[model samples]
Target chain A: MVDENVSFEDNLKELEEIVEKLEKGDVPLDNAIEEFKKAMDLVKACDDKLKDAQDTIAKIVNENGEIVDFDVE
Target chain B: MVEDYITVSKVTDYIIELFRSDSNLKHVLIKGELSNVKLYPSGHLYFTLKDEESQIKGVMFGAKYKLKSKPKSGTKVLIKGKIEVYKNYGNYQLYADEILKDGIGDLHRKFEELKEKLNKEGLFEQDHKKKIPKFPKRIGVVTAANGAAIRDIITTIKRRWPLCEVMLFPSLVQGERAGENIVRQIKRSENFNLDTLIVGRGGGSIEDLWAFNEEIVARAIYMCNTPVISAVGHEIDFTIADFVADLRAPTPTAAAELAVPQFKEIRNDVDQFNSRANLAINKTLNENMARLDNIVSKKLFTSPGEIYAPKEMQLDLTVNRLVHSSKSLIMKNQNRLDLAKSSSVFKNPGSIIKAKKENYLLQFSKLELLNPLNTLKRGYTLAKSEGKVISSSKDLKSGDELEVEFNDGNVNTKVI
Candidate 1:
């Protein structure tokens, strides 16, 4: 699935490989259309990820060695 | 007594002048253990030098004393400087221009020795370094719980790559137990499955940053499965942890920058790939369409009858041959019929029939001449008595019943 669960790196890499294959122009017309659609979807997903990026709340290890939210003023 | 009372500033100035004039005080060297070390924001160092019996205040001006590793508390050092009196405090202190580790057990010497040993042991080999993940989802930082280093790392990572999660494995970054604390945290970080572990602290004096130089801490970083980025002290300071770590960042923020890729660059890559794919697929479609057009424009498709033109000509030739042959055959049969009709028997069939009839009549008359009935018709009678013909009168007995056959009549008579 071309969703948020997939790493941005993996999605980008897959999109790159597909583009390379399509650029070779050896794929059948039907498959070329399919891969082209997938590439577009990946582009949107990556763009969405970038635009929706929010500041991550950092976590800290307390003195007792347990992780908890680290809020900065 | 009132006239002899000199001002406090006046007396302090005189003492400062006396120390300046003394040759011994101008370039004095003192060996002592550093204590109460503090590097102010203005780059000035204020510390106390203490021997077993006594202690003295010392100040190292930042402009003149740029050190690779600043001296921290408990670091034994030999300082070369002239005595100077602070105008504000009016207390005389050592204004050091040069400071060096006194002797054995010096932090710098220990760092060099460990670095060389680790290098010889191949712990610092490039092959041993793991590649920091290009897009790390989880980054673990090992540093003081409340320090600029942690804040810098977390803020940098969050700003540049919010998609990534930052986990802090807070540990003492200095003091006696700092080394063991760092080693323990590094070991604990292994269980978190961190993509990158940034073990660091903000810039500080060499002794404050000494935990990162510990052999145990270096080995922990070297053995860590996660890629470790060592960010200790300042840019000029390189610790043993830096040598053993997978990568070394001049500062903690730099470590976060190295751990994950920026979101904008990744988006651009994906956009480029999309355009390329569209271009390629469109090119493929265009090429196929062009090929189809080339085929559709062909004579075979444009003028479909052209395909069967030769076969049609062949069919025409075969039909012409059949019609011509049949007409010739009909003409031949008609000619035969005409030839037969032109023969004498066909032109004069009645005369032939008459001649055939005359010949038949003649044969009939000849056959009639051999008939005995004809003799009866010529007035000769055939007489028989008891089915026997009478040839002579004596053959006929008187009173014998005889039947005479004439041409058209038969008479039963008795001989008289």
Candidate 2:
């Protein structure tokens, strides 16, 4: 799997597929362990992405694309 | 063709003469509802004035009144004007020099008319609505910069879908220019390449939210290629923009909720998947281990000589059957021979042969007594001539020389 640039939903879908594949028990023993490890990493990654998020609103009319000061009603 | 025909100028002049001289057509007051109101950039009012029966084309140039906006659509108005014929179109129209807003008594009627017109044009169709993306990386918000509408949308989107970047295109929410400005901002947001857009304002009176009802704003919302969500003033006030937009959220806060999903919910889903993966792998391992344990427990497979023991038993059974059958066959044949030898035929063979030999000797002796050589020995005198014994006297001849032996020998003789 590509490590970067995937959206949360896309990444989550892949994680779900991995879990399902592991659950079906068709994978070899070595592959099953490896798949389990990958799933753990994805869980951690998703959690981190959510925790690191911050909300920002920016104005695009200016050159810097910053928040232009306006009267806050 | 021109024998007695009236000129085009003459016909136009006669119509103008009728309009100018008519008492009611000059400086007359007419009461009706207004429709299709438009305020031009030059501050001139252009619209149609109509009652239920009919409508008249009209305009009030900017040179006359200088005050607030041109009368909003659906306003019952008393207009004083003179009917004048346009030389270009050859149609008489009212040139309203004075317009007074009697009252805006038919707002619902005006709303229904515009809605019906737009609906007939297929603006509110389901097919025209676009699906909001489940996850948006960039969202453009077309709303006033300072109000609770923008603040709520930004906060809600950030809380639920934290990765989304909000681009604000500030716009006027109410005024004569509000609808036009909203259209301008929506058009300008196209450059941002937004995944979705929310155009809304906080709660207000219907007249206060009238900018959203403007056709310019509705048509702009209809024509935008981007998916738009209209979150207007209140739950009860439904505007034309709400119908034309891809989705209608009751309030600005609700629009943010609709735009993005909850982040925590998906994390829980992933956790469930993680456990299920573990459960499946463990199940396979346990089953295989059980199968191996079962196979190892059987003594037939685990120990040596298990196969050889059965084969030895089968060999012993076959050898015993062969020996028993051969012995019984020899004994049966020997008993039959012994029984035959014990019968009377062989034991009495000598007695029977002796009796038969004695009978043979008696018959031989009788035969010897009847032989001719025996008769010579008894009493017969043999006269001999040559080798014959003469029986009759006539048989002797003079001068014969003879010798004779009766039974045992003969003597030679000659005839004389």
Candidate 3:
């Protein structure tokens, strides 16, 4: 159950592994196609993460609590 | 009225009384670097506090010692106490009650002590340090949100890779309560589900960056489940946080760079993988196709027509031989009939008619000899049962109903 907020490193690593397996060329055609699809998805996920990045400025209000915008500062 | 000159001791006493009477001189906070530091056998400290231009004598009674580290020569310190004039020496000195190692030296001493202790505890061991994520979805920063550190980090991450979200856990970077605040923020960062954490502060004197050097903040960075990148002060300012962190970045911007990758290079890498994938699949398909070609080119498929041609010719040859055998028999019979007609029957027609009549009479007499009436006259009787003549005894069952017909009479009986 991978979520929407997967880290960039994990996604890139999965893409790398898939590409490696694909490059080895030992897998059957069907499996190679599946690996190719997975690689493309990871690349797209990484690209989307970069594209969707937003600027955020926040401050800790409590000892272990939410990050509120430090608008006053 | 000319004022008379006072004695030297009397004048020095007056100056001392004036210094003691002044509140500013009695309770003061002074910042300076120490020089000529000495500890007496009687448990007293003597040092000169000096800045670039001036120097002042300082003294701390042995009873007033509250320092974790003894002050050394050239140590920067902040001294608090009253100014006193030693009448005999005719020199004024700062009688210190509290001596705090100031700026770089004071915080640095504490930083080193904590680093040594934590290192022995294996907190700084390589295996204990988690690898900083190469690609981070969220980065938690424990620093002032409005400061240059946060701004630099944000800008660097955005420029290199924009997909990552930067979460700032604003904390006090300096002052008496700064270490507690930084520790608090680091603890809160655990809830962020971050891939990497950057705990740092901007460049300042050691006093301003002291929070990063504190043991509480260093331990907090060590215990974090998420990988930590410690970036404090300038390139030369090392802190305990840096030593305990998974990675040490010389500056806040460098921390951001360490946590994420540049987008352009990643895209190029993915493009290479795409081409490699195509080549691999095609290579497999081409190899399979060549194998199929090798099989199809073998003699089995190359000359299929010639392989079946001999069998077809053998079937046709058999049919021709069968037709010739029947035709040859009919022709031989025709030749025999022509020879017989010319030599015997056509030339002796009258003799042939007589012989034919005689042969017919002989065949009729022979037929008469095989008649059923002659057998009956020879005392050969015929019997029938159930309109069927039984020729063998084995044909009859032991218990049976039988009807027997003899010559001219019929009888019914149950066989024994």
Candidate 4:
């Protein structure tokens, strides 16, 4: 499953591998269909990740060694 | 005599004027080693210029000039200043306007020495360099809080990969204590779980950027678990931190760029992979379907009977031959049998034998009829010339000799 534990890079790598295997055209029909489904799921997961992205504000470590939000003025 | 004596204040003023009026005392250049250097909060620098035989107090107003080389206690320098007396202390000091470093300066020598030592220790080896993550979730930057370096890093990271959390560990990036301050900040960055750390500052002179060349800062960067990108100065400026860091970006912006991939590129990659997968799967499905169609279109499946229709036809012909081949032969023989059965020989055997007797009697009678004796009995006579019988009367007249023939006897007679 494509979740937080599996990084986006890993998910993408898996997706690429699945696509490569499918392109080789020797896979059994049943396994190919199953892998196709898995690949689509991975694509959707990646699309969701890209769409859900939000910019995070920068933070700073203060003189007292405390972490706080400090935007660049 | 009491009237001639002047007040101490007046005498001090007079001395101050005398020292100022002396042309030789004004605008003098002196070369000596700096000692007891002090920089006040008021931006004034005071130090002692001392030689083996003599020493003097010196002051350089900070606002007047900036020194490329920061002079410390043991630094040799040439000072251009005017000798002036302070009324409050009743002492004269060199009021410096300009201070030039006498040689390459201690900072450069120290930088070279530390660089050589660290190189020998193999801190800059390629094997020790850590790989920066292609997609970092958290990036830490250690630089001056209010400097261009921090701003550049933040802007670049935000513009390129905004998904990552950028943490700034601002520290003093110059002066004597800057090295320790930067080390502390780097150590602090470890707790934040930074995937990459950018430790640097904007461009400055050799003396201004000296903190980065410090051994403590270099070792700290080397020891940092997170991959460190050192962006100490502009492209031309190289620092010890740059050598020890996992990656060396020419500037802070470059450091941030090296830390993470561009967001747009990643998105493009995903989209490309998605389309490629789609095309591949579609092609696979199409190819498989085509193969199936080819197989299904075969006579074996579409019309199974047609597959063996010719064989079936051959079998029917064989069966017909089997039935008719013997039947026709037997029918022909039966027809022959019927022909034989319809013949008189098989229908009336006794009559055929009686007919055979009568035929023999008739043949005998005909044979008897053909006999000349029977003709003689009918009173028919035959004449012969020599041994030949004469059928014509002309041949008998011409014959010289003739024989009169009767059914029972023959007699010789003369033709007369």
Chain A TM-scores, per candidate, are 0.77, 0.69, 0.70, 0.86
Candidate 2, superposed: residue stretches over 4 Å from native: A21-38, A57-73, B1-104, B292-416
- Candidate 4 per-residue C-alpha lDDT over B95-162 given as tens digits, one digit per residue, 9 for 90 to 100: 99888777647777888899999999999999999999888889999999999998998888888877
DockQ scores of all models, one per candidate? 0.58, 0.34, 0.37, 0.50
- Kindly report which residue pairs in candidate 3 clash with one another: A9-B135, A49-B163, A50-B163
Fnat for candidate 3 (0 to 1): 0.46
Count the clashes in each prediction.
0, 0, 3, 0
As for model 1, its CA RMSD to the true structure in angstroms is 13.2
Distance (Å) between predicted and true CA of B349, model 2? 66
What is the TM-score of candidate 2? 0.52
TM-score of each: 0.69, 0.52, 0.55, 0.59
Candidates in descending TM-score order? 1, 4, 3, 2
* Clashing residue pairs found in predicted model 2: none
The collision pairs in model 1 are none
TM-score of chain B of each: 0.65, 0.48, 0.52, 0.53
Kindly indicate the candidate among 2 and 3 with the higher DockQ.
3
Question: Which candidate comes out best when scored by DockQ?
Answer: 1
Error of 3 at B172 (Å): 0.7
User: What TM-score, to 2 decimals, does candidate 4 have?
Assistant: 0.59
Give the CA lDDT, 0 to 100, for residue B235 in model 2: 84
Q: Flag clash pairs in model 4.
A: none
TM-score for the B chain of model 4: 0.53
RMSD of 4: 17.3
In TM-score terms, candidate 3 sits at 0.55
Instruction: Name the candidate that leads on lDDT.
Output: 4
